[model samples]
Target: MFRWYQRAQVCYVYLSDVSSSVLEGDSPTSLRRKPAIRKSKWFTRGWTLQELIALARVEFFSKEWNSLGDKQSVLLTLHERTGIAVRALEGSPMTIFTIEERMLWAKGRETTREEDAAYSLLDIFDIYMPLIYSKR
Candidate 1:
């Protein structure tokens, strides 16, 4: 149940049984009619690079993203082609990863969660670059 108040009149909008009429030429429009559909910007904020990668990972692993349907495909493609694991960026505040940090995590050197927390940007790049780029 939703109730809205006007300066002189109170209007009650319900999910069912609504009727109204409008008169032209400086006449007031009755409240009983369907309200005009006001459209505003739906999705304005865009995802950061890291967020995109993370989302790709979810779509890839879950195999739920669809190009024609509600499914997404870009994220999964990036993961499959690159062999890099993407982590969820939901709770994290930082949107973009430094070049070195991206190299390390994406390359797979920081296998354990603990190691990821301990490394600096340079350290991560050094430890993970070889593993990620290895021929095998």
Candidate 2:
């Protein structure tokens, strides 16, 4: 999936848990409420981290499918929301950053399945571990 993301022409991120109908207007109210976009659920998911980093160009959409912005347009917000280096968001090779820094990217992300937390990171570290659905 990580490799597929890297080779994709573009990835469209649908923020299903966020509504942009109120923020999409051109009025001053809407413009001032741009910060609302940062509260999207995508930022808290473990799997989306890989998708965000691997995809060269990501076009973000709201639950209503409203065009929020592309990766470049929201780079600063993405950095502030995720604490990911702007260079990484800009497609820098993962090897250039230390393992600690790379691991920090998934610091607060959550996975629904117990083993998924471990699974979510395999690609980021270039490891191939067999799936182990532990009962713990």
Candidate 3:
């Protein structure tokens, strides 16, 4: 359950299977409110092709990438979301970004070469790919 307190800019979320007293005297100043705008599960906001590609990269290539089948998983997820076919996603090496576009891709416009810094195609496929493509 979620309660919206507009005046205080506070939102109270009640999780299942826990004591309710924790929230008895809470105030917005005491709560950890994430500023990000979270989309509901039923809502898929419009996505530009570039945004999709960029997000795919980040989601697939996060750290812990070596834990499982990453690339294949991302391909499968892309296929499922797009119906473009896994083979095609994997086989086609279409350039997701051009050299000139790198600046735009940089995380927060930081032009750092540090591996942990900005955005790239390799990052996305390294993590969620296997889960997405696992043949069950």
* TM-score of each model, paired residue for residue: 0.19, 0.86, 0.22
Candidate 1 per-residue C-alpha lDDT over 18-126 given as tens digits, one digit per residue, 9 for 90 to 100: 1121212354332211121011011111211222332312221111211111113233333333333433232122234465545544443232334333332323232
> Model 3 off-target regions past 4 Å?
1-43, 54-56, 60-72, 85-136
State the weakest 10-residue window (summed lDDT) of model 3. Answer: 34-43
Q: What is the lDDT of residue 84 in candidate 2?
A: 87
In model 1, what are the clashing residue pairs, if there are any? 19-32, 20-32, 20-33, 56-75, 65-71, 65-72, 66-71, 66-72
List the candidates ranked by lDDT, beginning with the highest.
Answer: 2, 3, 1
lDDT (0 to 1) per candidate: 0.26, 0.83, 0.28
- Per-residue lDDT of 5-85 in model 3, one digit per residue for the tens? 112222122212222233235554113111111111211212222233333232221122221123343344444444333
Candidate 2 local Cα displacement, residue 121, angstroms: 0.8
TM-score of 3: 0.22
Candidate whose lDDT is highest:
2
Top of the candidates by TM-score: 2
Residue 79 local lDDT, model 3:
43
Residue 93 of model 2 has an lDDT of 86
Answer with 1 or 2, whichever has the higher lDDT: 2
Full ranking by TM-score: 2, 3, 1
